[model samples]
Target: MVFYCQRHCYETKYTTKVVSCKPAKIDVVVDGKKKKTACYEVTFEDTILFPEGGGQPDDRGTAGGVEVVRVVRRGGEAVHYLAGGLEEGATVTQEVDWTRRHDHMQQHSAQHLVTAVADNLYGFATTSWYLGEAVCHIELHTGQVTEEEMAKIEDTANQKIRESTPVTIAEYQASDPRLIEIRTRGLPEDVVGAVRVVSIEGVDANMCCGTHVDSMADLQAVKLLHTEKGKAGKTLLFFVAGSRLLSYLGECVSRERGLNTLLHSCPADHTRLVEKNQKELKGAQKSLREALKDLAVCEAKTFLGVEPRPPAFFHHRHDGDNDYLSAIINEINDESVLKVLTAGEDKGPGILVVHGPPALVAQIGPRVCEILEGRGGGKTRFSGKVTRLGKRKEAEKYVLGALNGSVKET
Candidate 1:
């Protein structure tokens, strides 16, 4: 079988025949280790699967019932990767993912129209473009574009789509005079031979190797969603075209409905309602925190006034902080007193030990860590968190023992 070097084959169809297939090894890194796996890298005489290049992803599909996991162009040849090896010179049918292909076509076509409009309107050349699954973006040569300017550009691009302008694909030799007449962002130095040009009827003539739709109408719409600054003062305009625009609109509507339900307010007044609710929540939280601080102080005073004083007491605070714990310790006012406080719900118990004698706390803090089977460090006034919730009692016992001189060091 003879293999023809028809690089533009993917521009027309979605299926073609394979010309050569061979066993190959691909290194895949799993858990930080590279493993070489047996696979087949098939080359087609005329391929409909576009390789990953030109800021567009490769086409996903299958060949001969085996999944084409990846497609790469190596020196003018499109190599299709498959886990299941195919026979060399076998005639296998390649099926491309239609949804993804169509989506790419819309996005790539939208990019060209948008780029052309921006250039024609403001002389802002497109520096780069990306066709993402959810959104597409093109970086312009300007620092930033105003909201009004972006709206104008978007309107112009969509107008072209609404006009149903024909998107023509043509190939030209490197030395062709017509090539110089076309608008291009300049081809890479390595690009040689026939250059494929995608032109949008009187709008744009760009030297692009990426696949595009047959007409601007197929794009359906081009909505410029947002713009931000990129590297070297470039302004990046994010947009959605075709079905993706519909998907984005659906999501926005769903979110608005949810917000209305939760806030019991209309979409127009959502911001005002949310801010009011937040203020109320903040005030309530402040009051609750003050009550907690008062309760902690009262509890500390009660512990201090006990008829028969113990060496230390373990207290569980629903929610405690450094200030709350310190206030409690201050009210007790006993040099020999030791207070071990814990505050947690589902999280593993955390320890905050405060003692009257700084030296004693410095010594006993590390021992508490050992007893709890956790890790911590402290200085003069020792305070550290405990991780093991189950061992909370054991940790307290060890700390109390050390304070009362009941536990001896080994």
Candidate 2:
């Protein structure tokens, strides 16, 4: 939207009503759209009322007697979209959401403290940053650090937060020491402007553009959430400050209570309780499968007498996969006269094999598999799968045919 600073700049318009939430929204044309600009944006020309351009989120507030829902940076210009639409050329006083702003200040300032302090303690520089709602992240200058090192970093950072050191903002010329220049990415070639250095007392001094408080002391507590390796061996750090710290602690406590009740144990024993449950589950699965195997062998004895001959059968189902199928095939090769049971699926499972002589098994597997689209292979001695599908009963018949060919008992 065009910024009209003086009467001469554009036709002047005024709000006859006192501006507040309830006031009738005047039709304000933003860019070309008819919408209200927030209270904070009412005074500035193209200049932004909120923070933008960095990874940090825009400052939120009210402008032009309307709620400033969001402050945004599109391309390069900063813009504020308001709740109540503004008139095409109307004028209104601006307002801001102050409490939220203070919270942001704490977060930004805490970032300064924790990052700077960690660097000093662990000798890992913060290579990059992204300021988000719940957490602000910084990429360490080095590629990676051990978990123990990260713990040390965290401990030192928190200690600094508790120390509440003063954060100083100072303007430095290009001639400033290389130490100060190291913080910002190298200056643009065309730009020869003064850079502002924000110093966190003895903790850190770096060039930064986003707003920060006067001291780390303002941050009630800086809490490190986690640290993990990133691209190029960089370490990413997540942290919370002030009110967010309190919120996190509260959530942790609630989770502990629920876990304690569910496990019927003290909080300290949660790890042991979870491990016990996992072991018990494993034991149960093993015992049930052993019983099923014994039953299957007994049932196979009855089927031994009534099959066709020389059947090299191929049947597959999903539940029994490649690993078990391979094992079954190995067993058949070792025994020559045998039955194969497999699970047929995409990966091939629930396949059945009944051994028999050549003539009876001829073309039976192919014809049966035509219904389920199952495939099998065998030499004079054995056949195995390339592909297979459903049609389990027909698959069984094919196996019986293949097996009948070989065994005289059947």
Candidate 3:
């Protein structure tokens, strides 16, 4: 449905008449499926809630006892999305989400002040901005920002907030020559006739349509959290304003206290303690690895001394790995005795290693792997791990059969 161009609804908190209302089909995701929800698309003759635009989210509240989910601006009309339908030409009392609206005002206004301060003091112009749930950020036309520079900008912004300067909204025609005196990112291509400008008295002025509080004092405060690199050599400065600042501080304090308890160290020493513990862990792991290698060498000796020379030797070891197998193979000096070693946990995957005569190695390794349903690659000394547990006997039988000429070598 088409809507006429009209004044913004947020100039004052006033009850107004509904100009139009119609059924709007919206797709909502429920249980991983899209379900169409028929809602009321409403427009008011005048309203107090701000439609989403200019990096600020839509205002939410109730209209005539019906929940308003979202508001959008097309041309001059403030479209409201309502759960239940409203009758056309109905007189409804509308209330803006005061908490949410006020929060946006604080963050947006702080953004303007901070951007102006950065441009004036550091020649860093604002390229973009975002008003997120817990934090807001402004992208500046520079790749990097130092902590000292951000601290200065934050201090200046809070100073302006403390001064409680008045903020004014004004409208001027597009053709007005006085427009040259004001600062603006630029006008939208579709904009016609007059343009609305929000001005912070004695500080800065810019063309904007989002709602704002009456004075800087209402902003409460602006805190710079950190900065990150952005597109086109830009720097994104993250921050929180007003009550969000208080909430962020509360969360940080809680985390600091929790870390002290968990680490059993003061906040100043937490990093040092963590680093020291990591070094100790690395040392312990090195010692354990060396001890395991020594054990592997001793195990290889027992199989070498066995008398009744079997066609091929098979051993099921419930521990160690390729490193252990290699250590044992390196110690077995006999060149003719074929060795098949399978090592793993009681009920887990197993590793197989075959070493000895080149012809026997080629014959036994492939046959053993085929029976166990595993894959591996090597010339004479072959190694591969099987997925099944306790299948060591099956692999050993295949190797023994190959030696007896009952199983064909691949």
Off by over 4 Å in 2: 1-43, 46-49, 65-70, 74-76, 81-85, 93-103, 171-182, 187-195, 288-410
Off by over 4 Å in 1: 1-17, 23-38, 188-192, 321-323, 326-337, 347-377, 381-390, 404-410
In angstroms, the error of model 2 at 192 is 11
TM-score sort, best first: 1, 3, 2
Highest-scoring model, TM-score = 1
TM-scores for every predicted model:
0.84, 0.59, 0.71
Best by lDDT: 3
Q: In order, what lDDT does every prediction score?
A: 0.77, 0.57, 0.79
How many pairs of residues collide in model 1? 0
* Alpha-carbon RMSD of each model: 3.9, 10.3, 6.2
Q: The CA-based lDDT of model 2 is what?
A: 0.57
Colliding residue pairs in candidate 1: none
TM-score of 1: 0.84
lDDT per residue as tens, model 1, 1-410: 10121244334344556677788988766798998878888887767777876788878878877888788777666788887887776777777787887788788888889999999999999988998778989999999899889888988888888899998877788788988888876876666467888889989888887778888888899899998889998999999998888889999999999999998889999999999999999999899889877988899888878889776777766477666777787777676776666665424666656465677777777777666556666664566666765666777777766755743453
Q: By how many angstroms RMSD does model 2 differ from the true structure?
A: 10.3
